[model samples]
Target: MADIVGSMRVFVRVVETGSFTAVAKENDVTAAQISRAVTALEEQLHAALLHRTTRHLSLTEAGSRFYERAKAILADLDAATDEARNASVSPAGKLRLHCAPGLAQSTVAAALVGYQRDYPDVTVELKIEQSMPNLVEDGYDVSLISATQLPDSIYVAQALGSAWSVMVASPDYVKRNGMPLTYDDLATHTLLKLETPVSPPDEWHLQSTDDAHVLPLTHAPLQVNAPDVMRAMLLNGAGIGTLATYSAVEDLAAGTLVRVLPQYRVRPFTVFAVYPSRRYLEAKVRTLLDHLRATLTPALEAVGERVEAMTNTIGEAAGQAAKSA
Candidate 1:
């Protein structure tokens, strides 16, 4: 079979110009190749498309009707192709996003605002929840998830960055119940456990530079399933709880919450940008993911710095208090 679209384009031009040689010259091919393309198209359609002569070329009745339809089809094809191509250069569409709990606030949310600002034509719809959404079923363009490991799925997971969960207690809680210094010490203190999709209810892994120690959480006096509730309880002097950097950034900076363990952090959770397909990733989704990686990664890094700074300060104070005693 012939390349029908190509032949149709050449045939339309040949009818308008009334010469195969003119269309061939425009296409940078010999007239013979152009003539052959028309012949193949005519043979495939079982109709005479052109009435050719020594000096003149004219379209048959079938060719005249086909010419009009072919022109419209070719115009539609070109317009659709241009629209698809322009998406990469200037993204303009609606992006639906599903974000995991505690991942949509602070830096992530701000980054989303920045993305919309930069791409004014794009409308974003965001849903934040604990349950992992079915990207295809739920009609989500992308999912921002933070987990130690993601479940196996047909989606493509792109690494955004990693964030450490730190043990935090309110100033009143620390003053009243005292702070836990080690894994053994933490076993004795009140444990306000946060149960999320990313965390196990039984244990919390305390990760240090050298190694990680699993702190068995056999006793949880208060167990909550949400980060906001855990933060609220910690603020009420309930107990020490784990908080991701994004969740604790403001509190840690404001001195409302203090780090419980300066030397050990809860095992880091990795953030991933999940989508249905990588090869057919659209511009809106691609740009938003890139914006997230650029914005969220830096924000997490800055929070990490602040975390270290607070840890150093807390460690120094503990050192002085021990020495004075």
Candidate 2:
């Protein structure tokens, strides 16, 4: 009967967890109820299922075989049911994602519309902030980030791509404080300092083609810790700003921001999606990561090409200056 099958599942859990009490708590039934179910199952099969002692529970040879087969049957049934529902509807579950504010707004947020359209049943909850959260403690299913590389303790991540920093200033700012034609001109202008969001905020690790240097500028004309705010200032001509190429895509496209010191590309930073583990990725989380990779890759690639093109222009200018001098 259907009831018998339901009882069998309870029995399977008892055996797998090795705790009748634990199974009872999860099933919202009494421990005695679990014992009774196993007893009835043993009677129906005409075999003893467990070797029990005062402090320990062990499976007999027959019980071990039964548990293995029963677990397989349950898994198969669950998978089949999921497939049937998938045919009728999209994935339905709450997926929580944490991301850098800039990345989330510019590209990740835009991609979610398409993901939602594809998986209408799934609800996405996003936490976009400058700081990383404890994914396990905060109950986030996934996180997306842009940085040098992730430390080992955090997550299992897939490297979506690498992006480099680009110097961008608003058209108004450049018009007022003539654009720096080369890295040497940086010293001549009022340098807008960006507070790196990394743990140690004081160090600005910037690299140019000629040499890599650390500018220990303890102060800035304006210091905004958040990338989103920095982008806003750069776009509004409040000050010049440095940000990952991915973060400046829209402004560059709309001609609000222009790349400066085009010959020198900033150090490359990696973009990654950190999930608990790639193997056990949940349906909703997996779907969203896949959607982001598919949707954002092209946009990021376009930004990279634009950076390279600007670099070429700076190189041409440098060559002309050398010839004239």
- Scored by TM-score, the top model is 1
List candidate 1 stretches off by more than 4 Å: 30-32, 48-61, 131-141, 150-158, 172-178, 209-212, 219-224, 275-290, 321-325
1-325: candidate 2 lDDT, tens digit per residue: 3366776798788877998899999988898888888888888888998987777888889888988988888899999888756633455777788888777877678788788889888888989877678888889887888878677774788877667777788889989999887666766665465554442345446677677766554555777767788888787787666777777766776778887765455667777788776654566776777787898776677778876765576568879999999
Which predicted model would earn the best lDDT?
A: 1
Clashes of each: 0, 1
* Per-model C-alpha RMSD: 3.4, 11.0
TM-score of each: 0.81, 0.67
Residue-wise lDDT of candidate 1 within 111-216, one digit each (tens)?
Answer: 8999999999999999988777888988998988889998888989998888888899999988888777666788778887888766786788888887789888
